[model samples]
Target chain A: DAGVTQSPTHLIKTRGQQVTLRCSPKSGHDTVSWYQQALGQGPQFIFQYYEEEERQRGNFPDRFSGHQFPNYSSELNVNALLLGDSALYLCASSLGKIVGGELFFGEGSRLTVL
Target chain B: AQKVTQAQTEISVVEKEDVTLDCVYETRDTTYYLFWYKQPPSGELVFLIRRNSFDEQNEISGRYSWNFQKSTSSFNFTITASQVVDSAVYFCALSMKTSYDKVIFGPGTSLSVIP
Candidate 1:
């Protein structure tokens, strides 16, 4: 009965470098969503994947992309990282298509872009 | 456009005191959902409760209670007999059925319970 899990829990990268954060959704969950939470701010929606396809996206720029595997695991990739990109990247999962269900979140991967 | 707002940036209360966190939301869809989450120093968001647009009944769970008002477009959370363990950042979120299940979060209200 493991909940959402993400890794690497912490990482550091410099400008013009890229970083990949991974997440395993809760057992029996099919959808995965990514969020970015800057210090002193709430989690901001990044994008959501369902059926291995991006179902929806937020206001984030193209530097941020993601993938959802057949196993319902997800990866968030950020390229050309900037200092502003340094934040807590979170992965959340829900059972059904609608968000009316509870969204379980992972501990989050903290990305520190220098 | 959809948005969630927690006007209270921070609140501090002593143990055993009661405190309420305010949340105001905006959405164009007729039917939507609202949620509350708590984030401790550990940084993981713990889900608290969810309320759909149609159901306005205030929910009570142990010492926690939520008030959902459609006319006001506000969903408020109240913690009774609070303890030191209750110290955390609380967030309010909104999800519209037509918006592809994307959850929009508020700025969050940081609650500090002093012993």
Candidate 2:
């Protein structure tokens, strides 16, 4: 069975530009979450999508948004990117909104905002 | 509010040595979950272990072990006979039972096992 997968392994963008990263969750999984990891730091929760709707969000600003399709695939969009936006964007998937279950993660897309 | 803190920012030890990473968390919920994940240079977070709030039993997996102490609000990880391959950024995370989708991660501890 395929695990969580993310596209655009690496990309570069300038400030004020918008970028979209994609993710396909593991088979038999319906929940998708996005995280941002800056250099030398741990992954910070961005938001989570369940049943094609956003279920929970972190402390991120409105510029960071996401969407989930019927197939459980996800997309994270960052608008008006700042230089500090440069980081590794990770996608994780789980079976549901259940607690204590393992979260399968993708390799992550490295975003460089100049 | 929930938070995870890895006290050690970085640690280095000889290949044959043993190292421990300390994690302390703060959570308001009575029922929650704790987790450990390893991230190598490749940037993917590999799930290591997960423990629920009620189960405080210490777990041992091969050369790795975890000690969960509710009294201290700390979950620590130990690697025995560490090897170079064990070098990575280790993160301790917490998720509340009420909001499992939002997993809060610690700043992470960078481990380097030198040969």
**Candidate 1 per-residue C-alpha lDDT over B61-93 given as tens digits, one digit per residue, 9 for 90 to 100:** 999999999999999999999999999999999
Worst 10 residues of 1 chain A by lDDT: A94-103
lDDT of 2 by residue, A60-93 (tens): 9999999999999999999999999999999999
* Candidate 2: tens digits of C-alpha lDDT, residues B47-83: 9999999999999999999999999999999999999
Each model's fraction of native contacts: 0.74, 0.87
**DockQ, each predicted model:** 0.78, 0.87
Docking class of 2: high
Question: What CAPRI grade goes to candidate 1?
Answer: medium
The prediction achieving the highest lDDT against the true structure is 2
Q: What is candidate 1's lDDT per residue for A34-113, written digit by digit as tens? A: 99999999999999999999989999999999999999999999999999999999999987654578799999999998
Chain B of candidate 2 versus the native chain B: what TM-score? 0.99
